[model samples]
Target: MGYGKRALGGVSALALLAWAGAVHAQDEVTQVEELTVTARRQTENLQDVPAAVSAFGANSLYEDQVETVGDLQSHVPNLSLHVGDASNAVVYIRGVGQIDSISFNDPGVGVYLDDVYMGRVQGSFLDVIDPQQIEVLRGPRGTLYGRNTIGGALKFTSARPTNEVEGYLDATLGNYDDRRFKAVLGGPIASDVLLGKVAFAASRRDGYTKNLLTGEDDGDKDTIAGRISLLFRPTSDFSAYLTLDASRNSPDASRTPHRETPIYSVNTGALRPVIADPDVVEATYNDLEKLKTRGAALTLQYDRGPFTFKSITAYREMEYRTHLDLDSSPDESFGIYDFEDQDQTSQELQVLYKGERLSAVAGLFYFKENDETFAGLVGPDFFVILPGPTYFPFPANTSGLRLAENTSAAAYAQLDYKLTDRASVTVGARYTYEEKWTDNRGEWFDPAVAPSAEDMERLFRTGAGFNVTGFEAEEDWSSFTPKVAFNYQLSDDVLTYVSASKGFKSGGFNGRNTAAAQSFDPETQWSYEAGLKTELAERRVRLNLAAFYQDYKNLQLSRFAADPATGNFVAVFDNAGRANMYGLETELTAVVTPKFRIEANGAYLHSEYDEYIDGGVDISDQRHLVNAPKWSGRLSASYDLDLGDAGELTFTGGVSYRSKTYLTVSSSEVLAQDGYALLDASVVWSQPGGPWSVVVSGRNLTDERYREHAFDLTDSPGVQLGYYGAPRTYSVNVRYRF
Candidate 1:
């Protein structure tokens, strides 16, 4: 049987087991714990929410070893998070996302820290430090999250200051020289009036890939992060919260690409073979990837009667610099260096009302941002000699700078009204106005007149060597998104909901292209969904299922295409006409015994372009969505054995599978990842209500080889490149909790 068939059969068996467990749960008395979420701007039971949401608490995160945001995709249905480079994380949900990570381009899925939105993907792959909860809201979230949430949204909430002292300390040692330390503490500062919390984490690891030229390790990890939170309450109805967080990442370049094909020289008309190895690369340029991110947020709230007024203000900044070898060769056939700086400020005012039969939330928001980037690229010699003709110059090397400024304002409101004892309806809408201004300047360099090292470094730092100004343009856009939902209680333990919503991702100029300032229209989506949530036998078993259909228009796509003026491969963005997507998702959790538990989730997705036109050619039938797979699932279990005097021992195991996936919009075979599965296991020993614990964990136990990101440059440079995932590894962790 094929890999796809085998994966499907395994997932089917797991689903069957979950179903059987649900049936048996009808006679059991043990209960599964309930999860609370704030997906709709209000705290409520996860099963009672009208939308599809995945929530993970601190314990769950630790059990799954979710150290970073990228670790979340394996547990979610129809979700993909690909870390293409050191800091660029391409995120997709339900077959909707953007592939590019330029500063000007917007993301389909929004990432939020606390209540503040992260403006760029350059730092969206945040480390999980002292986390309270993390929530993934699937589908469009335009009603509450007004900008760039056409696909979905992710929310990370940290632990807050409390009146009582609480904290934990953990140290970990693993293979590949992995070392990690983390500490978190929270306590009262002044009786019940002031409270404070602080968290710190430091992690370092050696790279998995080896650089043959420099004898250095690539794909490494080194980072330090800290966060502080304070809460001041002078009265029972008024409160203030302040949060500050910062992180610094300095690691050896980890995006070491391996060549999939030999280099085809356009000038020599011959192929140059490369070393055929996935774990080794020959690159002369090896630089440290440096990224720094910091943010601050302040929230104030006042309550009167049944109405509460709140205000949130925040500021965030990020700086990133990196050098990458695109050709993965000893010589600098194709390389790139980038320096980016960005900052943003936002303000939000909200009023919430809670009543016997009606609940409502209304908000006004404003955001402003400034971003600048300087980039340089080195390409192979582009001069060619024809029969009985002199050589002609074809400049492919380029240096450029782009500066962008954006501002937005929005007004939103959502209300839920109870019609009968078992029925409720929700209505919400948001209106947003946005404007953007951009300055693009760049010039192609002739190989015959190569610049000096000092000049090249100056251009990379200040973007001053460019001789041509591409364009300066300003654009404004407005959108009105709305949502409606109906929820019904079928039984004491069953809830059903149907919803329809519209969302849009903002449009922008091509930040990498210097020939012209081009703009694409905003991509929009209208989704209709139905969901069922059930609990049986005193909540011993919980099952949630959802089905959705989406009408996607003006789908945004990004690819490396030839520049019209210089014939150089540069990142470009455009829009496809239309597409349709439909999918089914199911999640089950059963507490079969007091010490045994099982969790299973699966997704089935089907997507097709209804109308796609590329350069006057109709190719909708030949194209597929990027980073989307037909089937994805995960099954995990845990069991605990009691020890009389010592502690309890727990054993946990999990397996996750994904079908074939295309990483680029072109759906090139060289950029596709085949069906694959990953296995993980862990053993933990702890005393009941004790402070000490030990955990031994192993990931990718089978040593599976897979590609997380791939670039198809064969058409331009005659070589394809791929970035492989991590191999098998194990770690030992010691923890102390108070």
Candidate 2:
């Protein structure tokens, strides 16, 4: 049978299990644990919520060994997460998402931690350090949480301090010289009045790629993450919590990722290297990258009879450094260095009310951010005039600087009311106002000699002298987005619902814009969906299905722009053409036998551009949306065994499959990625009534070769560039709890 048939049969078999269980195991029937979630900013049963949300508790996270957010892609359907380097963490959902790598352009999706919003994409590559839960809500959420909820929202809730003393230590070792350790401690500082927790995690790994030129590793990683949280409750109705977190990474790597040896050069039309094996690459530069991030948040809540009130105040700071060899050659024709810094602050006030037949939440949010950039591009020792072909004995360096400030204010409210005992309706609205202003400046300097540190310093004099001084631009926008939904309870174990919602993203100045036109309008999307959730056979089986159609306009797209000074391409954001997306999704989970459990999910998508224009050229009819996979799905199974005195043993395995996907907004036909599949497995052994355990994990058992990011460099001499997926990896871990 084909894969698609197998998928449908598996789901059908799960439904049939309902009747089978009704006859075989009527005496020992036990349902799967019902999960609780804060999807609507209020605690509620996951199955009772009238939305498409995927929630993973701490136990699930441990079962999958999900340390980084990127690992979620293996299990989540209709989701794509890309990490080109340590700096770019782009996320896409349901054929809609963001690929903005810089700090200026905002993301299409919103990311929140413990009710506090994160505004930058550079720092969104989160490492989970004892988070209690992670929730991924699909579809528009603008009315629930403003700003960049056009695609979806991700919520990561940290674990809180408990009255009882608790702690855990976990250590791991893997191939590629990988080493890691994590520890968590929580206890009561003063009985019931005060509590606190501390968590720390660190990891290091050798580079997957070897630098043939330098005979050293190119992408080695050394990182550390730490967090501290404290909770205070001086009164029965009043409580407060404070959290502090920081992370740092230093790698002597390059923007020149592992590149395939040239086969048939598009630029020269000549055979260069016959590379039958994709595992190896030849590179010449030993580049450098450094990053640091720090943040703090405070939350207070008070119960006031029929109403509850809460406040959140947050501050964040980030610093990033980069050095790259643009040519990726030993000749050093061109090289670049970048230094960037950012700081942000946010404040929010919330009020929630719960009545016998009505529930509501109202919130006011304010945000402010400041960002600065200083960068330089160094040219070769000898250059030539274009077309005329006259070689000049001069070296020129290009420098640029930009500083931008942003502010946003918003008010949102959502209410759910019961129209009948089995029927209900929900309505929500939000109004957001934002403003951004930026100052841009740059210059070119030449020393008329062989390029050297001294020669370049003498030409530009100092970094301060390269400032462009008198260019400034500002943009302001206001938008109102709304949501409406109707839900009905058909029976005690079945629900059906339909929703209509609008999403919006703010306008901003393109930090890399080299012209007078430096800003683009905000993007908007409207989505309509219908879904059903059912519990069959005394809760032994659960199935969820959803269908949606979405319309997007004034889409925000990231592309490369020619930099006149450096003769290279710089990232620029623009308003691309509108697009349409429609898809079907289904998920099933079942407890088939006493020792076996199975879960599966699949998504089929059809997305295309309705209108597209770039540089006065219309290409809407020929391109597909970026990052939109034609089809994707996952299937996983687990089995448990009881071994008397030897304790218990468990085995788990999963397989994920994805169809063809595009890599760029323009859908450049040459850079498309074909279909691929991955296999993963794990085994665990534990002691009875236990405090200690061991686990062995393996990923990509078949060693599938794929590309995470692929691009045909139109700006740099028609070269094809791509970042290969990680090869097969293995790890063994030990854990102790007290």
Candidate 3:
């Protein structure tokens, strides 16, 4: 059978298992455990909390070989990551996510590292290092998280230095010339006086894709990161900690070209003739990106027997620049482009208090960013194309500069009154005030000539004039969000709960304004969720299931159109739509036998735009939104075998699958990536008494070709390009505990 057929068959089989009461039977015999989470003001078991949440610890991440936050989508139901230009990633939960690419604004999903907010979307894709735990809280987290959490929040907690001295190093090498190295050390500095730790990691990978036009390597990647932390305990009542980190990334292009002809037919009159100009080929370009990020955080804690107080302050800065060839056609000269610079800085502070049954958290946040961009469309001189084309330049030069600032302050409190030992009702509310400002300037110039000083001044002044007339020319906004939840335990091994919450995304000015000035309103969402957690059969099995529905209003939509007068495309942001989403997520883990274990997780989503108006036409009630998928899931199994005196060997394998999805809101044409399942396997061997071990892993054993992202141009017919998923790869590593 073909790969597509096999994948479809597997999906059908899984669907049958889901519907034939097999999953229900498995849940009955699973034994769930108590999971502590801070989704509420006070610590409570995840099963007892009314909100929909998924939590993963260090051991689980290690077993899954997760290298980045993007990898979490496979393990968590109803979640996916969207890839876009300039390292801009959009995270979606239950079919709700923002589609804009501007970096200075907020995203539909919020991400927090050690309680410090990361305001920009581009920087959120940084590598994860030495994390103690990660929590994905689904639905509106308005009461505590505040803005830009219309979908949910991702919280990462890093491992801290301990009183005991400990350290470890890991090294790996794999197929396609991939190599990785990492080291970590931590210990007490002076008994209870101080503690410190340091961590460093580096990775390199050979290009996986071969450029058909240039025969050059693409998809290459390199990353390096380091962190230092210090903890001080002055007295039994108070303590403080400080941490600093830095990271650098240099990566090659990952863009793929659209096929000019159908793969099944050669002479179907569909293929466009390849351009023969070297300049065009060069302009069709591929380039590189270099990004650096630095951050520092300070945290203080105090305990007074019955109450605990904590305060955290943090600062972060990120710089990113890229040079890209936008046109993937064989003719390179026509589609070349470059991004000179983009940067952002943020500062935040948070304070909180916790007690037996009551807790409160408050914070202040500020962010600022400045971006300068230069781009040119290169082609042949006029004379090369037509007769008497003297001194006619084919390249068009365009440049833009933008400055943005955002500031906000918020306070929230939650009170839990235990009516009984097994039942509790929590009431929470949050209030937030915010302000935003932006300034943009743009100019179109003829780069061939060196304009006189006076001419340069004139051009700059004209650009400023355009900014005065086009931009929003002001800054400020305010909002308030609230939340409530209830929990009930049926027994020691089973719990059920429900919750309702509100979420918001801040409004921002439109950067492109060739058309009339348009103002956007903050998008809001109200979510309702219910879930059940159960454990059975001597604590050997666990099952978690949740269903949620959300109603969204004033959804921000971006529209791009060509200006007949300037012949340039203009983009504007407007609140032109509303949507509703409903979904089910289920996870199960079973230790069927002493030496064997299996896990199965899946998500099913249904979303629709109830009201959508574009260009004064109703395009509402669409079946699918761009970059949204209806079904995705993962399944895996592992076993441990005793090797006698040599110790033990552990083997693991898994497969992940995603169903077909559309690439546009209109859903006029389907990307139709026939569902694909990637096969992965790994093995680890270790000695009983030694501090040494070895591991080998392989992914995508079948090397399936699939599209990660896809889109078609508005003016072109059947002309589409997309980013392809990774190919087959393998890695081997040796590690030492001390």
Candidate 4:
């Protein structure tokens, strides 16, 4: 809760909005429009695009109730979505990411759909019921987005199935036992030759953390989804579209709650009281996580009346499995059990051309991944005897295994030129190639002898049998990234920009707990950005501001140790020696009088560590940059009256804040969370020609206890473990349209 007190509270909220100079007349009475984006590959207008993007159409995520993609970290701007435990999640932007949860590893933000390419990270936690837009391409998009992008890229677009018939349906009920459902259905099966759509969604929840040693209930969840599409238009030069999507996630019974331990008794000065074990239903450290995803896509279009051609083909498959309980200490002698499984495949090809000022794009990408894991060390086998006697034993066999394979290919291009009438310029490039291979098979068993030929030749000699060992290697890499941007339009709703970019992420093999075949390099970035997009006053306000600086190289770091010769406990993956990040982002919107509206967003980051090395000591890089958060903000408001004959009545509210982060970036003994502000309110009542609608929401209206990641243990400094956030809840929704 201290980064100089959230950078002096964001500089006193920008000096109270510059002493309220009517805040530019609240963007000149809210006329703000124009915000189309494709991030430099056509379709401009996000202040003409020079990078540092952020968009969320689909009616502003259904008026900001944003149901997934982890709710866009409460209105993005420096984004974050840590959420570990139960299938883990780590998505930091600006300060990079990945803390370890191996699955052909690679994520520092990169997720696409509609241009397909979702290579794990649980496929970016789906469930957004249907989208027509969602783009968040900030910094380093590696020239037209081809590799990892350091910390950027999240795109999704879906909504195409028209030739008449429309669709809608939504339902929800909440407060812990929550339930949700969604539906969509589209038109024509053969009116001018085919067009169709289908969509479905389901959700169920029942836990909200409360396993104080098993008093039961601890964040449970379940989900299901489906999608289908088809479209074919013949004549006037070609058109085609096909899509299929699927999802399932069943396994999440989140837990990690324990605190209460105090005792003092030296024969007389006594004080002791400790109890916790409400019939332990589950949580000797719990585990559960199962996931599934499927995909297929095809899009083709051609126009020939002055050039217009496009093609997109995609195939994706993802499967995930998790069972973990890496000790949150419910004391089953401090448990440990873990598992992982993954599969991936991808291919992309693109082409685009638009005239009337020049626009061009080109692409080819292919990816493949096969990951398999069976991490080991699952509890109980005990022995302990004391008091003038000694005996300590516990060993029941096989404790390690990891296998991996990864492959990649890429080529990309972009161009945009419109040197007059508001000037514009963009150029891009991308070329990538990657390969990785790993195999580590080491197992030990001796509950009292049975295997020995020198322990089976030290478990097939690759790193020759554990205990402070290392290496089982194979690696390959190649790279090229380039970008440039410039835009200017000093009128017609102003815009100005500047940019520079380069980003990439690819490098693998850690095979859990290191046996030292190390190999990690390919974490690069070089970004510099500047921006301003405005539409003030008479345009109903809309403003965007951006500033960035990045220069991070080979920064991957992941460490956790305890291997005084295989007492087993090692998780090492390293490559960190340079870092530097800077940021400032702002967004504002107003429609201040069309029945009232308002929006605000903010971010301010500043990271460090220009070189660090630990345990062979070097450490001095100012620390604290793991989950980066220096300041974050969000605000929202809405109102629409006029209920004559119950026609309309709407109200909405929002607030969000973040500051205080570091779940481990080589420690600062700081997990001081304590900067929380969340409030969401809603109410809607409508009726104006009947399609039906109703809404009632109340999320986290001051039921904040906040703690999303915190940890410490060096023999337990009073044992701290965390992950809690999600309290006040309430919901009721209904919608319909045929």
Candidate 5:
């Protein structure tokens, strides 16, 4: 069936809500639930916050089937997530984000786990476990969220330990031999003085993409994760919380790149004929990937009168290894092996005060990070192979090692003052200083042609291959960011606010450069935003709207291209001169009746580069911003059916849509993703006042095929690759509570 017809099915779900309204009376209208959030480092009502924020509670998360952080993009407007590898994924909010993933590069969007910042993006694709709430803040959070928040921030708040004993166990079964198990428990450890909580999860699934050659799958998953939390209360005014988490993913199946046809060779200036069928997964080489992550954090707080003192300390580590076959053919034309290790430590101190007409927060922060990486590539020496019975031997090899260390210190303060009964103003600023040091080296060798007598010794040597070049460099940077906002209450049910903010990302040396260690300048943004939060229809409907405009300078950009000499891909970094971004977002929720609900949200964005010069030539007109879709939206509906003593049944269904998206800066038609839509539905049955429940869910019911990411190398090595999104899947879950 056509996709247009499938989309109409989603519209039919919303039409059902109209029929439900006819059966219910006007007096049966239900009120929307109130939400509380910590967007500005303080607890406040969601309607009272003077910014653009979207939040999902525990119940909402479950209904949406949010298994991992990547799933959140479907429900949030103007947000995108692209999986580049097994261990890492790139996140974009509005139209700003980083594209390259390496040891030295930082993420544009910041992610926090229980108020602790995560330093590396490698482990950001975490599994959601017993989460209490998740919040996505749009625009630049310069004052309260620290550095690298030019795009926005994502906050994950997990359920804390309580004095009461409570827990749940869940099991799931699905197609493709999918199996999952999860357990969570919380109770008092030592009377009223201590409390603890523990959670563990294990999941495995067979791959869905069939390999025509090996008769096996190529996209399987296997993972295990656990978390532990402890809370201590020594006095009425003092408390401490400690948390530890660990996860490991070692999947046997890996992604098989789908080769785009009609690719030409750079060596002989001729078309490279397709070696295998382009329809199915026919890669001749097997790929491997392993990732491990660990983290620990401690928070201490003391309350006295109208002030609260807080301290937080955290440490985290991650290790990843991968082997990839780039050519997708039996001929070892291009292969990649990479190893990465990263660790970080951080400390933060804060003081908060609340008064009759004035409220304020002040804090100091420190962070240190160390990381090392080893990358090697093997390919053909001559970059060409004759036809027939000739067997070409691979002789070219290149390797590199990169080591970097960074230290950062910052101080920030924000204050909110009320000038009248319904009017207030907020002002805040932060100053950050950072120092970075890097050591990079590379070597190139051909066993039969180079001086290296032993091929094994050359492969094992540290810092050996792009002509044996090495460099060491150190640099420091400082920035001061600030924000101001004015808020006013139009009535008891309406609020309006306007704000201006500035944010910046630190600069760093490129870790993959074969010659001199090249450096890129920092990027900065100035943003202006206006928002309105309102409750209408006698408190039965809620609507929120926001508009934003951002001006950016020294925009950092990364590009990957194949090198004909070694037949390997190389990444290069540079600064785009200027850019502008503007967007509009709106969210609406309506409780039509006591047992029916409908929700809708959408975003419209426009982005363009003001100036871009590469190799002393202007290229601004040909480049497009990556991960920026012109339009995105979602629509959903849910209904409840009460069966008296039997129990209750809830039904939910939704569809998410995205316009055309560019995967690279060049705006190449071969790497752009067309408009697409996905449909999901779920049904749940629960026993009233009981501890048992069952849920049946289906995702991508329309079976739409979409591209999540793509790599364009048609000019140099003449290879274009595409990575597809997941196919249709279904599962059934059972849960027991105590």
Candidate 6:
């Protein structure tokens, strides 16, 4: 996306903070609730954290109808998430992130469950599974949580097993034949010594798109996930937790009407759109995806007075496969069959101590992984051997495979010292070392296309026709990240802090790509931030504001291009250039009356390439990073009432807005989306503190049509690829608790 100099929308986005306070004053109020989060590696009140953080409480999640981590974009400012294909996704925080879904490159945004790192973008579409809380920490996080975290981090905490018998059953039925069933059942296996919990979640829906040629439903949904957790506490000082999880997701896929998002044909110099409206598609192959994953984690903690020692060990594996018609046409001109297999294991040991004047946490971490990928493409049918002669037909079927092994280790320590009762200083650093070994091979052959030796003699001698190259290579990268901060209490009700941190993402061998671009160098970023957290109006209102500036270097860039001879797909990677981003964010929560509450979040961002050179072309200042919007915001309100004898009723509503955003750094005029708005609301009815309840919720209530991804089909210029956001969806959920 080209970086156009447009208005930043700073004034209007920030105005939400003031507007919310004024609107709520005309009504009654409720008390602002305290939210605790693990943003700092230790449990602490959200209002006490010095960094920029947005925490979702169990109640907030239900009231706001937040389903998955991706849904948080509507409620959290400065954070963005979207997916193009099943395995193609990106997460951006403050204009910094990764868009390459290649198996070789790890995500810039770190995903963690109970402190266990999830390093891949594939299979990261996590659904809330009896979760107690979710926290999103904005900005670079390296001192405490190392790994590929230059954008930020996402933390999810599931409810642990409890001795008391408790769980819930949830069911939902929606339009488009959507049906969902979920259950959480658990209790004490042995009263005080052991507790266990098991959960099952499943959802299925009919496709919304009608296939014009095949008369089949496209874009359906089929997903199921289950988890089992156990907690053991034989002694007061020793506690342990073991968890096993597995999930399978197969969501139907569909493309938007070509007319809605047209692409230009270089040959004709005309715009072409395949079809329009009702999501009608003519495809020669299935554009569906299937993903499966399994994981196990064991956590052990030992505490002695003011000192605690902890160990976390985890193993995870994922398998993903997909088939798509690259041309988006009914012709068998081009298509792909992609398969990916990945497995990883990690271990961490840490020690924590709290003294009268100092507090510290030190840890060591180890991570290892084995990943493999295979990409198949139907090459163009007509091709002439070099020297340009009459077109000769060849098999034209091409495929490539990359098998890799990765090892990573890190050691880190953080310490906090008190200068006074109201002032403190903190320092931390982590050193990480990583290495990757990869074996690559390629094949271009088809007995069906062209099986003549007369066509192979000259070409094969020149290393051109049906060429196959195999090689193995290794690369290693290391970095030291550090952070420092100072906090001061301006008053009993307010705290202000300033912090700076450095973060980096390790290099790796690019999977499913050309050997020449097989590896890249590590990328690094430095960020400085200042923030204030306050409790105004006698603790009835809460407001937190922060500003940050970041500088990035050696940003890895990935894109798709066609092989000159066969017109086969190739994923190319390069340590392109640098970028600078700065932004301001604010969050507000106020209780206007005993029965009413209002919350607001907003951000204004400015991002641009400081030095970006693409294909020996200086594109700096011309292209903007993907997912970075000049302004974004969300406002929400809730009201609760007690029906003395009948039941309790609650009403909630929210509206979110995002400014225009480019789909990619090489965004064309057609690859950008204008600012848009989304409306959501929910009504809850239940007996006061009862075990049964019903919720009626609606999302995208306005039914706005927007593009989720606007991809340039480099291999096919006549047609562009686009993914559309879901339209208005409503669901009636009934729940029962034990």
- Tens digits of per-residue lDDT, candidate 3, 304-325, equal 7666677677777777665444
Candidate RMSDs in order: 4.1, 4.2, 6.5, 24.1, 4.7, 5.7
> Model 4, range 1-738, lDDT digits (tens) per residue?
000000111223333333333444553443545668776656777766666677777755664556777767767788877456545556778778775556646778877887676766765766687788788787778766777767887888888788889898988898878898899999999895788999999898877765655576765778888899898997768988899988887745644543324222222223223334321223555555667778888878777865666767777776655444433434333343445566666766677777788777887887877776655444343223222223233433344556777788888888878899898888888889988887766554442442322332334344443343335777888889888888898897778888787888888766664445656778888888889877665656566788888998878877555444433344667787788989888877655565666667788899988777776665655576777778887777677788788678678777888887777655635344656778788877667677887878887788886666554432211233455667798888887877
Off by over 4 Å in 3: 1-35, 41-44, 252-283, 332-395, 447-472, 514-517, 564-567, 665-672, 716-719
Candidate 2 lDDT tens digits, 1-738: 001111211246455565537544644655665778888988998788998887778767876777787788755667888675436667888877887566667878788888777887777878877888888888879887887878998888989989989988999999988888999999999998999999999988887767666777667778899899999999999999999999988876754544443422323324345244455445543466788899999999999886889999999998987765544444443456666789999999999998888999999999999998766566553233222222233345666577889899999999999999889999999999999988876656643342433344344435434333346888899999999999999998899999999999888777665445478889899999999988777777777788999999998887764444544445667888799999988877776665667778888888988987876787888878888897888887777788888877778888888889888665666567789888889887777778888788888989988877765444432245556677898899898988
Using TM-score, give the best candidate's number.
1
**Weakest ten-residue segment in model 4 by summed lDDT:** 1-10
Candidate 6 clashing pairs, residues 3+ apart or interchain: 1-664, 1-665, 1-666, 1-667, 28-592, 28-593, 29-592, 29-593, 29-594, 30-593
Quote the lDDT for 635 in model 5.
82
Best candidate (score: lDDT): 1
Poorest stretch of ten by lDDT in candidate 5: 1-10
Q: What is the lDDT of residue 575 in candidate 1?
A: 88
Q: Per-residue CA lDDT of candidate 1, range 151-174, in tens? A: 999899998988999999999999
Evaluate model 6: give its TM-score. Answer: 0.90
Q: Is candidate 3 or candidate 4 better by TM-score?
A: 3
* Model 3: number of backbone collisions: 16
After TM-score superposition, the amount by which residue 28's alpha carbon in candidate 6 deviates from its true location, in angstroms, is 9.6
Q: lDDT per model, in order?
A: 0.81, 0.75, 0.64, 0.67, 0.78, 0.75
- Model 5 stretches with alpha carbons more than 4 Å out: 1-27, 262-279, 284-286, 380-395, 447-466, 562-569
The estimated TM-scores of all candidates read: 0.94, 0.92, 0.85, 0.34, 0.92, 0.90
Winner on lDDT between 5 and 6 is: 5
* Better-scoring candidate (TM-score), 1 or 4: 1
Model 1 misplacement above 4 A:
1-29, 265-270, 380-396, 445-454, 457-467, 563-567
